[model samples]
Target: MLIALFQILDFLLRIVGWVIIGQVIISWLFAFNVLNASSSGVRGFAEALERITAPLYRPIRKILPDFGGIDFSPLVLLLLIQILRMLLGGLAVELTYSDA
Candidate 1:
């Protein structure tokens, strides 16, 4: 049962990681003028991503120093997510061994 829980958490973390990646790509597109900022569709998509990721980035943003116009919150969040995933994986391994 605990293993199943860990699997679920891992899957959710993967989804969050993808969402962060999507936001980063979208921001790059906007920055490069590849995506139309005037378009409602593009604006809506960007807004949605911002809303979803804002909470996750808030704390990290506070802790990280500003680098001109650059944002490192997403990268920091991704790294933290990877670390959590590794911990979950290790715990799951221990559980599997103990069960046997």
Candidate 2:
């Protein structure tokens, strides 16, 4: 049961990590204005990215110290998601080994 739980968490963390990466790429395109704001595809991706990534960024953004006007929320969010993935993966491994 615990193993199953850990595996589930690991899977979810991986999915969230992928979404974050996608959001990061999409954000870069938007930042550079390479993707038109009026295009339906861009708009759809923008909305999905916002819906997925904003909650993770909100708290991190609040606590981040200013650095010459640059925002570090994305980096922080990435780090956190990666760390969660790692933790879940480790738990999954332990659970598997213990079950064996």
CA-RMSD of model 1: 0.7
Q: Which stretch of 10 consecutive residues in model 2 shows the poorest summed lDDT?
A: 69-78
How far is each candidate from the true structure, as Cα RMSD in Å?
0.7, 2.1
lDDT of each: 0.98, 0.83
Give TM per candidate. 0.97, 0.80
Over 39-96, each residue of candidate 1 has an lDDT whose tens digit, in order, gives 9989999999999999999999999999999999999999999999999999999989
The runs of at least 3 residues in candidate 2 whose Cα sits more than 4 Å from the true structure, single-residue gaps closed, are: 93-100
Model 1, TM vs. native: 0.97
lDDT of 2 by residue, 1-100 (tens): 8877877777887788788888888878988999988899889978988898898889997898779867688888778878887878887887789879
TM-score (C-alpha, index-matched) for candidate 2: 0.80
Any idea what lDDT model 1 has? 0.98
